[model samples]
Target: MNNISVIMIAHNKKEIIKSQIEQLSSIHNISMDSITIVDNHSSDNLCDFLVSQSRLNYIICDDKIENYSLILNTCISEFVNTQNDILILDPDSFLLPETLKKLSCALNPDNGIYAVCPQNILDISNDIHSFSAALNYVNNNDVSKINLFKIIKPEINTILLSHKLLSEHTLFDSEIISDELCLTDFCINNILNDQFTYMADNVYQYYIGNHNSYYSPTNRNCDLAYIRQKWHMNYINTIPSSNLISMINEPIDKELNVLEIGCDCGATLLAIQALYPNSTLYGIEINPISAEIASHIASVKTANIEESVDLWNDIKFDYILFGDVLEHLRNPSKVIHNCRHILKKKGKIISSIPNLMHFTVLHELINGSFHYTDTGLLDKTHIHFFTYNEIIRMYEENDFNVINTIASNVTPMLSKKDSEFIDALTKLSSHKNDMLFKAFQYITLAEIKDT
Candidate 1:
């Protein structure tokens, strides 16, 4: 009857298991009652060590259970009678002393499931077991440590599931042979069902293994593609019925001729068409596939889809939109300069750039590693990183006057104390020099300069 139950599924990670188990056992507030380990058919004597320690309950898989889903489901099924909060941990995952405490503090009955470390480095070498193994490799000297006591979106590894919620949602997708989408699909499905809110924050330190190919860049890329597909499939259906128009600050006006750069799938364009039916909308995109999809969406919406044109061209436009596009460009300034030229006097340019300097990223950066992933500032396709001031300067230098700037309030991924620690470090770094220049993203509305 401990507050948490830690479950780990390991294959042949003999070298790291002892240390990982030792670290978990040492957590200040957690008890032995909160832990369980499932060793899938391993060649090493992992079972003997677990039995020797007598510290954790271990389940060994025989030839009867061959797949990961069966192993995971079997383990969870056994824990069903425990009636304790369950945490799924990878064998290579190393927990900081305060990790569980912070994660527990962030857990809420309202949020269906929670994860301490939402995203970490995947060790592709672990793919032989059909599970994606990840490591939290932060350059501690360079990156700041994160506090995990904050209620936030669940991260990639390390999930916390309530016993009751587990009963309601059933177990992980045992059918998905690859662990790639099992957890995510389950969580997203539950979230959509309003069964539980998926909360994640950076709470665990992962020591990635290179023994398998689960984390190889290629596999990671494939996982990302799958994630995006899942995300789109699960969430895209809600778009047409969603109240997205309210998210836009100013509605697209019928009198204005608009240019939307990076019009992916026409979600933004279609939304604009709904708002201002008479407005002429133009889109520029680099991905032909996405462009085709967007064109199709536009056609369905009965909105005009113009031929793809480079922004550097001299075509005049009444309004230009960099909508979630600036961060992807190598030289955002060049695009801004070109936009300045095309915009008529008093024209507006509205843009949305993902904030790379968000507190989560700041926390990750302070920890010392910058790894690209499926999402966030490190998105593989992004070429430029800008802070709030840099964004303003980029526009101002190109003869555009900033009319309005809105900074979205985001929840911190770390606990208040850890966030404060990061904030202190950020301030110290800023005072020593200017650090606001590293803001995550900037949303700007600028006016073209008069000749």
Candidate 2:
């Protein structure tokens, strides 16, 4: 049995809320016993209509109340202690009956699973056979039967949280006024805590629609400021992506040791050494000229990462940097493993790679153009390409606990307004998160998992 309680912040849109509640009621064994709807001062009769639903408990927040995180916290706190999982939803995102069933299947307490997300097959709900179709889908759980899903990350649209997180009221940030910004911050915090979140993306389809129509633009800048102040994280821009930067962004105890593979011309080492001037800088580069230049700032060695397992016999670094270097190696996984071996007990590795699913690459593939240029997503130097899912799997396989994942340059650089590809994406339903194809690069930070 699934101990699921549904909670959604419904501001308005009488039609959308009405449909969502009806759909939730029809799910097989799921009932409205612990379900709740927060009517955020709806101008329409939605408040009255929601109250009319005797099955669902409803709350009407006054127009003066603005912080959504506080509202969700209050509602979750009222739940009975027996309810150990809360499914947060957006009225625009409709889930099939099997959505929770699959989530429950993956929510094994032994595995440290704390959250779940469903695979959304783009807005194909109108094409969904029946509620029973979902039932059959989950029962079989065949990989071949599943449609392609965009990697679903944690978003408020449809997510299941452990009751421990909700009842303690730590999942959502009360200080954050922007809902999107708040969820992002929440995800970042959870990741840093070694909390595991699952994406049961292949199990069922979640119809996507206007999940953020209520987002307030006025609060965006403030929320961003809060994130920056709290994390002390500068956005990863033109600099080579490095997890060392995140570790060095704030003050540290003593001078540390840092290493970079493929230290190309040593620009990265110079930049980072400038920030943490006291730390010793080291580099391993294959090109003699680049290695020579890198020696000015870092203790540069002319060597191949794949062949140099003994490159650092006596030294264990506090941090290792791999900025767009792994994808070029014959066995990126093996290179990562060797790097991990040379790290101090708590050392970390930061990496960045061009996203294979970026819209420009997808669009070009759709148009039958499969050519590679000098740089960018299809850089000829790239021997291995990865999507977000593959990147996560790679780190986990190497016995590393991914502390954080940062997606940079998403959507803005690549979207086309009048292209056939844009229409293709529009037809598919996402869980109101950024389209899977929108990201340009994924900059990742991971540390060696403790034995």
Candidate 3:
């Protein structure tokens, strides 16, 4: 077995550190001698506590290096040897019994995976018995049974670094000022290098405290803006729409021509290309930054999709996808009506539209707070809102017949005080499954109405 060095950053949280250390010590594969605590000049006598623990190693950082990158680089240079695999751990993370073992097992150099992270339970309580129960559940159940997420970016809290990866690249980006963003930069670098990060879905890490407390609001905003400027696009724009991808039900063998509206980074188009290798993919993205990235993957053009029907008048598409785009358009009905000119006779328009009549929206309105947010049901960019009936009517009125509808519902937790309002609303609604109160979005497939 290769030497594993456990790296932990401490900042005035002594009790949580103690609990984390105790949990690490319980792991049979890891020894207490391998752990190293880098104290960030804590005034709570955390360094003194580390000094008393003879089995574990520690470093007390002085006022000389205050920046997170410098401190991390200094510790890596001094403590972690070239052959050692490093585990960067958050102090508030409570590891399951087999977390280290699972992480180490998945860190094989043969695979292109450079880093391994355990699944985090952010809402989990700090109970050892609860962790034990979760461990048991993980052990007995198949991996598919657990709700696993396919992540494009690295998650915070607990991550294991491979020695092969560390040798090739620096662990953290010195240019990034924020500690949180530096890791994100590192992840982006890994992705660029064609190396990947794997999440150990079977392994669990119990996280305590607010995840956003590490960086101040000002720093976070500045760093995010910097990252966006550096990367040419925001992280959210780069992510593929999984729900929209699932709504595409086409024959695998048939080579279909597909066009996506607002194909931000061409991620979904690229995914479609993968699904149908022989198919042709086209995209229209308004943002030039994201359009440039997506242009490499598909025949992407930058245009205001709301008024760009002239661009695709000569070409006919088998499928025109609007993934949460109609709501953001000033004239969605006009766009839908214009689709007939560009769509093949048998072609269909598949759109994922947000439900305006969701319980959360109703609840907010009942409390007199129908406020707009960055992204959600009441997004600042959304120009139109539609319920299920309105969505069907919109398509039918636009010379299209609704072929199928799939509801994506999420059961919300309502306050006890608002129960009476919801009860009265449910009693009045005609939908049988409380779909009006629960359906978050509707993925509708519509075809041209036969004259």
Candidate 4:
């Protein structure tokens, strides 16, 4: 086993830091001297607590240095030459006994694995609060079972990074500002160099802090913009659309042909392939850069959906998916009409369209202000808007029979204040419903009418 040095950052989290150090001290093959705590000038007498502990290494940062990426880079630079590996741990996260062993097994430096992270229970849900609570919860459950490992960009919570990789290259892009984005940029650079990052499914970690607040709104947005500028494409387009995925009713093992219009970076298509492994996937993305990325996973064509009808003349698909694509079309009805020719006789169409009747849009209209944002219900590129009924009507009018309508609500269950407003609106209007205010998008399934 190679020597692994641990680095943790502290910012006013005295109790969490105490728990972190206790957990770190219990891990096998790790000594008290190997852990370095960089205190970001905590006011909770955390430094005083650290001073009492003998054999522990600690550094007190000046109050002026607030950037997390910069602090982490400084620590990595100092330890890169001496340590065989470095483990960056979050202050509020607790690792299980087997986490390091699992992560070490996955991080085969001979196979060019640059970084590996344990599966975080907090990533699955937000119900668990602290280390003790999480430990109690997992104790009652089985821990031997494991899921398949995933290849993903590294997040800064509990990743074990290779010292060799860090020494040969820059540790983190301090310009990214946030630890997550900084590490993600480093992981991407490693990937481009034929190295990889893996998520160890069998290893488990529990996170309790509000990690979302690690980056300020301004800095996060700027970091995202910097990443977008560097990647030469919109980063958000790479996220798979769950609304559309939930509407897919096909058998998981069935062999079929799937086509996604406005597929962006083919994330949705790749997700479909994951579910329906025998399915042949295709994508129609307008952005050439996104299409190029999509091409690696699916048969992608870089062309506008309306003008590319003849592009698939030689092919027919079992399922045609429109994942928030219709509203962006200049003539959505014409495009839907044209899709009939390329669809199989009994083919179904699944679409996830933003609901214009959502409360947020209604609230903006009530205030006499209708503005377009970069993305959302009133995205600047959207040429048409539709309510749930209108979306169903569009397909029915296009000679298709509506099969199902699944509402995807971003808002939580209505609160008393929300219910009261909805009740008042229901008394004044016939078009009002509780779902209308709750559902941000509607996923509709349609099949061509038998002639």
Candidate 5:
């Protein structure tokens, strides 16, 4: 891959963004033009600074879509379609002079490997200074005697993604929605278990305590809940994605029309491609970058009702999907009402919405720490929140009869620290299964009612 693109998503990191950009531009392995900054509507001087740096490709989200996974996925959607190799890094992380060269040397592009991870990650937030200075210290005569590339444990600091993962349409899930956790999931679940990983002997130092993070502490903790819910009870691989596959009771053995809303990179559609090879697929996404990528898989229209409704016209559909999308809308009920006009006689509305009454939310409420976040169920962009009953009621009100309802990403499935937290809660409650079933998202399959 001749083209190398570096995507750094940051908001309000005024001090760190510039330094990170400088460190990146200094990389001899990649050109400065390849560096792209994703500014999430930062109030900091990041936007103005980015404007001055004409060589950098910076996408300023005027819409203020704050979902972390959505932001990352948007960048991936833009570049993954090309032959360019992608490097995703934390904005405050400093790369050594030999960092990119070592990583590039370790990667085997022809083997369908998606990423090569860093071997030694020196988290020098306590003493992190200039990249050149850190490199100088590492290269010091006395320090050079020590092995700098001996770490065996994998990390989420920096990941170099190959075109193979993009060709497969794999990206960070907008639903899971945490930067560190998402990278960890992509590395552990998608890459490490397979032969798709290349562990490079390079070091990266993260600079912290320098500027404000885009996310608040509460937001970070809330996102951690999702990571917890995913691995809950060690049920990792089964972490529900679109829930379309689980909720679709009827078969699509015949020629049918299927539509997916908020289909970031058309991931779910890509997964079940073999099942509905004959079916005509359509996608409605809010992010333009993701919409472009989804276009390759299906007929795509950018959404929020106003844009896509005109594009969809009066055409009816067999299935209209909403995978973790309803919450982000200003008026979810109205959107559902409008979607009714395009539903075929037997068409089904399939959706996976985060549960506002999740066990973690309940715990947060009890602890008095619930807050909106850049990601997770309480995503800042989410105007409408739903519980299990609310979702069922929404369908019933929209001329649809719920046929199948399944709980996904349940608290009992998480294998991490929160799983223990869930266990403690479950033990105290008399309603054990009921408490355990307060899933992260509720998946529903509703059939259209006769008018």
Candidate 6:
């Protein structure tokens, strides 16, 4: 039988650490001796509090070390001296009592399960959706054969690593300051080398927060802008030029005219140009800074996309793309109506909106917090939310027919198995008896009717 050691690392998470510990304590079946916490120079009195707890063995590291992988490896090593099975946890991750036990039972010492992650319930926040979006993009259809290493690079939270696996791979590299991609890089390399098999099942809940290593407020507002631009540019350069040939559902042979509403930095427009050599793309942006960036990127790529929202009235388009933009608008319906007017007969509008009804959002609302962020369904800039029905209604109301709808990030709620419990909780939180489930958002396509 494998003995389990839960290793948790923390920095400035003092405010939530005590509650996390308490929650861990309340876990019914786990032995009290199995948990360990490492505080890596938290400026607060988190260390003192942990030391006083009789149930936990705590370690305090010097303040100078800030990289999470180093702190994580140290905690695992210090607690599980022998090659015991270990579960690494982020401070914000919460687990049910039976979670660890289930994981332990599933581990095969022969094939050696590299790591197992619980079905994550992400806390809604800015850039949280980007990760969610990426997850949705990968898991959209049949994910059984999806290349895990190619799709998801490792990062922090909800990973269980075997001691043998750790020893063979060596401790996480301390030199990588950027926590965002380091762990994922390690996981990919190791998985490719067949060091261990990565097995993720449904077990834990992740409280999405602004403090995650990559999406900090400073990075979201600035660094991410550059990163997204590069990602977009790379995406553009990779596709074949012939892929740009215009193919609206319509059979029209007229030169294709494309409109990209809310074209942030024109990366997608540039991509469209490369894909459809004969097409003319137009970009419409609301933010001047982003618009200027788009124009600059266009110039740099030598992509020809007529840019201007001022020309909205005179221009016509065979295809218009919303590209993760509609949900941010105060009135997405109004925007759709406007797009309908400018679209030629049978022209299609393609969009990718976050599914506001995603299971993660439903999980959060039931738990009693609906904090909004600068991105995703709750982005500070977003004034509207949509469901499949709502989006269909909006298009139908605008004299457009709903042609196709693809539900992404459609993972079921971690707590959904307990529908009765969820219903009971919903009743308790009801004002006038509405379930009030918050969806993550959805993407849809609609076509304007011919006269």
Best lDDT goes to which candidate?
4
Worst 10 residues of 2 by lDDT: 144-153
Which candidate number has the best TM-score? 4
User: Order the candidates by lDDT, highest first — what do you get?
Assistant: 4, 3, 2, 5, 6, 1
Model 4, C-alpha of 217: deviation from truth (Å): 2.9
Ranking by TM-score: 4, 3, 2, 5, 1, 6
TM-score, each model? 0.46, 0.51, 0.70, 0.83, 0.46, 0.43
**lDDT per residue as tens, model 3, 268-373:** 7866775677789898988886676566667888999777754754789988999899999989999999888898897889899999988789988878998999
lDDT of 5 by residue, 345-409 (tens): 97888888888867677778889987988778888778888977789888899889999888887
Give the clash total for candidate 4.
0
List all candidate RMSDs to the true structure.
14.9, 15.7, 5.8, 3.5, 15.6, 15.0
RMSD of 2: 15.7
Q: Please, what are the lDDT tens digits per residue for candidate 4 over residues 368-423?
A: 98999988999998999998888888898899988888888667777787677667
Between candidates 4 and 6, name the one with more favorable lDDT. Answer: 4
Cα lDDT of model 2 by residue, 1-451, tens digit: 3487888787766888877777777763657766788887778778888877877777887664467777777776675344567787877666766666777666654555667776654532444555466555545555433321111134435777776654443647888776666665565455445454555646555554645547566666666677667654321122333444654543543687889888865556755764665778899988765565456557889998889744766998877888778788889888888777789997888888668877678768879997988667888878898988888898999999888888877655443563456557656736334455676788788889998
Per-residue lDDT over 1-451 for candidate 1, one digit per residue giving the tens place of the 0 to 100 score: 2577777777776667776766666644555645677666667877677777655677876443244556678777675345666777767656544556655665665653333343342332333232222222332322234433222123334666666677566677555443435554565455444443333334444445442423246544554566556454312211221222333444445455667776654556655655666666677665554455455434212221233234434556666666666776667787677665567778878877777666567667878977887566788777888777678888889988888765643443547775566567667764532234234455677888777
Worst 10 residues of 3 by lDDT: 143-152
lDDT value for candidate 1? Answer: 0.57
Return the TM-score for candidate 5, rounded to 2 decimals.
Answer: 0.46
- lDDT to native, each model: 0.57, 0.68, 0.75, 0.76, 0.66, 0.57
How far residue 64's Cα lies from its native spot in candidate 5, in Å, is 36
Task: Report clash pairs, candidate 5.
Answer: 231-413, 231-414, 231-415, 232-413, 232-414, 232-415, 233-413, 233-414
